[model samples]
Target: MNNRDQKGFNANDNSNFNIGKVVQNFASPETRNNSETKLLNAVKNEVALRLAQSLHRRVYVELDKTEDPSQVASPWSMDVKLGDSPSQECPEGTHIVTIFDKKEIGGRLLILGAPGSGKTTLLLQLAEELVQRAEANAKAPVPVLLNLSAWKTQYSDIRSWMVVDLKQKYGVRKDIAEDWIETERILPLLDGLDELMSQRQETCVQALNDFLPDWTGTPLVVCSRFEEYQVYESNLGLNGSVIVQPLTDEQIETYLCRAKCDWLWEAICPDRDIMNPETGLARSPLFLSMLVLASDKLPPELWRQDKSAKERRRILFEAYINARLSCPYRGGENYQVGSKKSDRRQSKRKPVRNPYPKDERTKRWLGWFAARSVEDAQTELFIEKLQPYFLKTRPQEFVYGLVYGLVLGLVLGLVLGLVYGLVVGLFVGLVGEKSSNTVETIKISWRSTPRNFYKGIQTYIVYGLVIGLVYGLVIGLVVGLVIGLVIGLVIGLVVGLVLGLIGEEIDTKISDNQGIYQSVTNSIICGIVFIPFGVLILTALHYFHEPMQLSEILAQGAVKGFLLGASAGGLLSAIEHSALRITLWLFGYAPWNYSKFLRYCTDRGFLQRVGGGYRFVHALLRDHFAEHYDPS
Candidate 1:
């Protein structure tokens, strides 16, 4: 090759032309793209699997083909529309995904259906399809399924909320989720718009409209009940919409026959004038599933009996709960056991014995929990949310809490006090047995350091125990007084462990003040710090159990934490030398003289001297004394 042709790595040149460098430069973007694509697919598959497992587990009874509207009969498809008004019908019969494909405008789809119309199932099925498509086409947007019921009225824009929801619900990294959302690389499949407050539905629709820019072409899907969505007159600006068709009588009969539920078929058959309001519910997939489940126990006469739709649904719910509770636990099927962990499938465990042994008792608790859920407008039940409900049911919640607190304080205090007293007695006996030649310093050492350190720990333990016991007792009494003992014990143990390990010492140091003032200052500091710490600890605990609204947490946490902090401060102040002397002198707050009190406590092994000052042998005694002094 000529020199001129070789310029800038000429085409024919092999020598001095770096193949490795060229390859590296050429392959960098391709390799990165491939890696990122694989990561995205993994995330999609993981999310899809988790969502699918949860759905299947929740709907444990197999939904046979006979029960499906599409398979057994013509799948009920809704009219396609742009916005709220009906548009020209281009397709004769189609499912949700086909509408997305054939739509002229953007792929924003709103699904309208009745309560048991299988809208959720359709959305999940569509999401699965999109997820599969995304795997093949790297540029295809990933499908993210979200429960609209869990979407609180926080975000003004749906896009912003989608980012957060993906991170929280699907375990997607915040950064990756944000990148996908901002880049329009995700198709949000939102289910349960009907779960929100009626007033909030229009607001959500408006938020969706506001979220999409004029130039943006990102697709989104929403599911809502027909009645609920119709309440809002405003159109949800979408390219396509459809309603899930209700199950027909033939479909219901076919399912019943296939499941060997002959009695149930007779109850809702055409011969019984099944079109009437009483027997009309047979058309709903949910009610049919319930019937199929309860057919063994529920007599056909029960279904034929005249009753309101609401009454029938209540009966069905009761029967459903009864059947599930009575059945043997199969891993994750037990509702009462295990937390809703981040990884749903991995977290499943063997069934736990329910506290309520009888099915009736379990059903009653379930009813109570359901009532509480309705009151709170919660779609999912958590044990933590029921804590407040338990208190509300008890007319004497406060009285019970106070009485329990006092009882626990006294019992725990007496036991701890006696144990420390015995130790003090032994130490005194030992010291008396020693020779007089022994230095006073060794005697002080024996009395002060070990004793005070031991007492500090005791105080923390007692306070935590007392607090935990009182809280748990109050909750347990409201739930079931019989279970209060177990609840209190567990709570007390957790609190004690947490407090004893993390408890801070009252710093007996103050500028130019060596004893009482220093201790008083330390108490104040401890109280202040405990406020946030208490909130953090309690919030974490509650989040894992029965989750509550943030507002409720803050209000309740602040009040309780403040009272706790003040109690601790006053209790800590009692141990300081000058403070004790002044309080006793000024108001006769304590019965004994300051010096005599010190000697009495020291002799009892309840306190130990540190330089010119004294501290309790255990923080428990100190806290008890403080609590007694400041009863309020």
Candidate 2:
């Protein structure tokens, strides 16, 4: 016999076996390069798509910057020192991309700004430029924009977190993502530093400092609010930092004119006090955009009111919501009531109808979402991540658990039996009540057969033995041993072989809708697989004990199999989630169709879509809604 027969296979023995190296040996360097190129292109496209969605077709404001010592690591403590030249200071209107290229800065940059100061916008713009360069040159590092807020819950190690983000968000293969991070092929553009809890901010900075040492050659950009960042004792070990300055009076005038907000400028120009540089709402690009969007609906007298900057901002957000709701639908052509041609077309085509809730209802729902997000320290809101705590009241929680358990138990019990149903219902209800807040990310894919035929047979043999033992015992207790042993052996062997022939894997495209679709598909597969097993069991039992008609036995078995398989597979989970969502709707916490509402909010400029989830366009707006939230 060969060495393989004498000595069993050892995966760690590279001389004998190594799946990765074996594959690599077969793949040419050119093929590897082409694969990497495709991955980089995908990363670039994802970044570009995010930029377009977040920017919302708004004009790019030329933000000014100054080298701020207060928010940056001291020169003496720095790994790279800024030269003793006054020119090192970033002049007004210096392109952000240029700042990264400066030898003194060396691409490790910290961006600091106040709330609503356009820090994220600046980072996204920089990312766009870097992505373009990476796309043009294969040697350049691909830019990836990630929110640091996920670090608190997902991972402690920055490098591991980055690899997972690339895999989860950009659909990069795990092996490829790991290779890129290890080789420093991607520039990390991390945002939302201030979104972490106050206590964890210092720890996060320390983590960044630790991570930066290993990532010496790679470019890293981090963004945070100056106020929150300044309080942290630890500072990011970066080459240099720049603070975003507020818009000056001249810049404000220029932007207003470009936006065709002449009426707004005319109104603001008369009251110089209202435009105070320190307290003015117009100093921030975000508030300015809101002003421009809501200008027509906002009466001039509201701007003239003597109110604190905070109060004025609140008023602007309220006005903006009202304006968006009152305005005619901008999504498509409005079919007038008078035209018969339009009516006929609308009837036949079933033109898309507006899905937005009423103005007040929309605000309330948004407020609840924002409030929950703040409490959970979550920046990106995934619909699947909604937890039991979201129900708010004890009664609501009890109802949710009860309903979830009952639905699951009922479906499962119908196929199994009454004893199984009661036991399952009690167990599920107890588990549901004590369920943790974290949502486990599920991945699913379909395959007709196991990849390895021998391995499949080995797995099925074990499965068959266990199933046969249990089935035989149960059947023997109910009927004769001869019949029990024969039926159990046949049933177990058939079921095991059938199951072993099928396989599953994770779908790399991690999106909310994609997940739901995969879950449904898995349920169908489970139903189909179990149909034959159910028919066999029911038919044998009827023939031995009750002597039912063959047709009746077969029909009953098929129905039982499908229901049991589908429900146990994934349909039950879907049902539970939907039931909870409906309960939340009943409580007026959210709409029944959360995905649709969130997408609509994105279109209205209140939220931005990030991968499969959504986040408020700005933390400032989210806070505004949270502060004014009245659940009652």
- Writing each residue's lDDT as its tens digit, candidate 2 over 1-632 gives 11112111111222222334323433433223644666556555555545554422322211111212122111110111232222234555566788777655667777887777777777877887887777665566767777777666446778777777665456565666787787777788999889887777777777777787677566689999878876666566665566776777777776666565666788887665557776677777777767777776776556665766667777788887787666544442232221335434433553245677477788889998998888877776777667676676787877777777777677767766767986787578646553322212222213223446557756986798688878987878878776687667766776566556544322333355555555567677777777887788777777676687888788888988787567545676576676677778778888887877887776566776655667787888898888886473
* Tens digit per residue, CA lDDT, model 1, 424-505: 4333322222111100100111223465556645776787677767776786656554345444555455445434433221
lDDT of 1 at 344: 44
Q: Which ten residues in a row have the lowest lDDT in candidate 1?
A: 435-444
- lDDT at position 336, candidate 1: 23
Number of the top-ranking candidate, with TM-score as the measure: 2
**Residue 271 displacement in candidate 2 (angstroms):** 4.8
User: Estimated TM-score per prediction?
Assistant: 0.49, 0.75
> How many clashes in each structure?
13, 0
- Candidate 1 clash figure, as a count: 13
Question: Pairs clashing in candidate 2?
Answer: none
Residue 132 local lDDT, model 2: 78
Pick by lDDT: which candidate is best?
2
